[model samples]
Target chain A: MPSPSSTKPKVSALGSFIVIVWLMVLAVAAFLATVVPEIDTLLGRSHLDRTVISAAQAAIAITTVVLLILALSIMKEVYIGRKLR
Target chain B: MLQAITVVLYGAIVSAVSFFAVYFLVPVMIKRLVASGHVVQDYHKPDKPKVPRPAGPALMAGIAASEIILYILTLDSSVLAILFTTAIAFVVGLVDDRKVMPGWFKPGALLLAAIPIIVLGAHPDHLNLIFGRVFIPLLYIPLVFIVIPIAGNTINSIDVLNGVASGFLIIATIPLLVSIAIFGNQDTFLAALPLLFTTLAFYKYHKFPSRIFPGDSGTVLLGALFGALAVAGSSEIIGVIVLLPAVMNSFLFLASVKKIIEHRQVKARPVTLLGDFRLAASKDKSAPITLVRLILADGPLGEREIGIQIFKLAVFAAIMALASIGIQYYFLKDVIR
Candidate 1:
């Protein structure tokens, strides 16, 4: 068998794209981490019922989860779609 | 000034011990393992050389010895926590290396590794989320159990090509070391040196055209220790961020396969070996998606090139991790403390 080639491979656009997506995810996560607590404090100061504040926090948390799922879905679609093409 | 000198000396001793231990032990392991007929074929290579595996004992020995010395000097329970967690993960991985285990075995077994951290009270109640911190006193315990298995299995999954596991560990570790140094105590920073140096020494042999593979034991030990370090140092988010590529690889694999199954048992490989020995993404839709496969989406490449690409992704993740650290330092400095 011939010796395997040692040619340098070009970094794919997809690799760069994935890194960008990762950054986006981090940014979103950081934004939520910063904002959610403030939102909780603001609601607390408004003298809203404890149940209402808790419900809003839970909703925000659920939305964050949904967003993460959507991002993963996009990643999977892009990966499979690229291969198919 | 005298305190600074002592800290430097301690760090140097830990680094030297771990580095030299793996450096000296790997060759002996190769000879003994091969003599005992415990070798596996390098599937990605053209020659199909039989390489001895489970360099785990040597790796564990190096890490444990260094951490033991650190604990003796400082009497820190966190040091003991890292050492015990890594030792337990090493044993779990070694068992898998010697036996044909089901897919669930390693992940399930790794959860037990978290016991040392919890029992030793090594983890913090608050999570550092870069922009803010969250006090998750009750939730953090379960998170510890989940994080170890995820970290252990994530590294285990990415050990596909030669040097990838060790190489990835070397890259992914930089941010952890940096984060620990910035936000953690001197002891925690000293505790992380062995991880960097051990993997560095192991990579000399485990790199392209590997002389010996890390197998399950080595990978899981490194991964679990990494998780333990992050937890012990209170840099969990930084750990996850630095390991995003491996985490993404695991996510893709699980999503594509839609089940917890051994890669060995999977009938459809994500990448196919070509005539020239370069790897191409499998055209089969049934194949599980992987980072290697994603990298090969554009075209086939040699194993070493693929490894380099993976490292590049890791470096990108490391940069992002550093940026996250910057965010914490510049913006959340008052909030975090």
Candidate 2:
């Protein structure tokens, strides 16, 4: 016979987890924004072909996407996966 | 000073028009909907009240009228692009509201909403990262197509509780407006006004103990408008960052369900109602995981509290979004320069 107000709201772990995921995603974005351009510059100085530089940039973009997917998977695992187990 | 005064004048007029349009129309739409027997049960409520639904037409009217006025005043094609994109999404949502379409229908159909933006050349060729911009002329076209559907569906998916969708939109749009004001032009910022004010108006009826649900039509329209504004304003990165909570909600549901299926098709719900009308996270492993469920993970809570929790997450995401902009402006100034 517990009334609705009888239960106090507890701080959610999921909230913290979401913030962690956001930071990870932001880190990845920062890496792309800063590090990738520097890598392009270094590659250009090495006299890499235009297509080679483009390919290298594309690889980083793909890696960024993959890293994001990994981050999401980790979130899923930590919250849903652990609960199911 | 004259120019600033004119801008303020137009902003005030458009805001008033958008806000009042929905404010007045929703009550009428509610009566009409209920008369036509278009109502849905509010399961979260203990008594299960049947709230009139599909407030889409009224919402569209409010947004369209305000945008058209702004367009006539400013002659901005970007305004037309947003208007058309939102209209198309409204139609698609209205269709789904009338018929039980496949889960893919809304997302797939929403892809068409991107057409207006693309054909009008409303988006920029470069993608704006926080620190700098990347020219993606070829990739930008496909990105436009992908982004509209994702944005439309993200808001739609998050509309599980009363007022969560509209309230989320209100909070989420803050960072977008800030970003647009900072990095984008005035035309796009003016174009985004209706979205903010219309939702503000509709939220009066859509909030806790909702008298009228926005239905699929209303949610999709707001979502599509958000997507359109982001692209047209070239604030795509900020837009995505602010929507992390809704995006995460969509991701969790899809991952748990392992498919693009309608939520109604799922037998096990992520949340269950207690006898006292509080919501508890479902213990059934088969149930799909959702943001609301996660919010209730610690214990059962009233619907209003859960909605507030989601808003808190959105506010946090907005702060992070602002931080991202700060990083670009302050920390990475040299690189961007």
Q: Which candidate is the best by TM-score?
A: 2
RMSD of 1: 2.4
Q: What is the DockQ of candidate 1?
A: 0.42
Deviation (Å) of A63 in candidate 2: 3.0
lDDT of 1 by residue, A25-78 (tens): 677667667777677789988899977876686578558857886887786787
Q: Point to the candidate with the largest DockQ.
A: 2
**Per-residue alpha-carbon lDDT of candidate 2 for residues A41-80, written as tens digits (9 for 90 to 100):** 8998999997888778878887897978887787688776
Error of 1 at A2 (Å): 4.4
Residue-level lDDT of model 1, residues B1-337, one tens digit each, is 1278888999999999999999999999999999999999998877889999989999999999999999987888999999999999999999999999999999999999999999999898877877677666766898899899999999999999999999999998998998888777678889999999999999999999899999999999999999999998888888988898898889889888888888998999899998888998898889988889888877788888899899988888888888888876675567543
- Interface RMSD score of each model: 2.7, 2.9
lDDT of 2 by residue, B297-335 (tens): 777889988888889888888888888777655643563
lDDT of each: 0.87, 0.86
Query: Candidate 2: which pairs clash?
Result: none
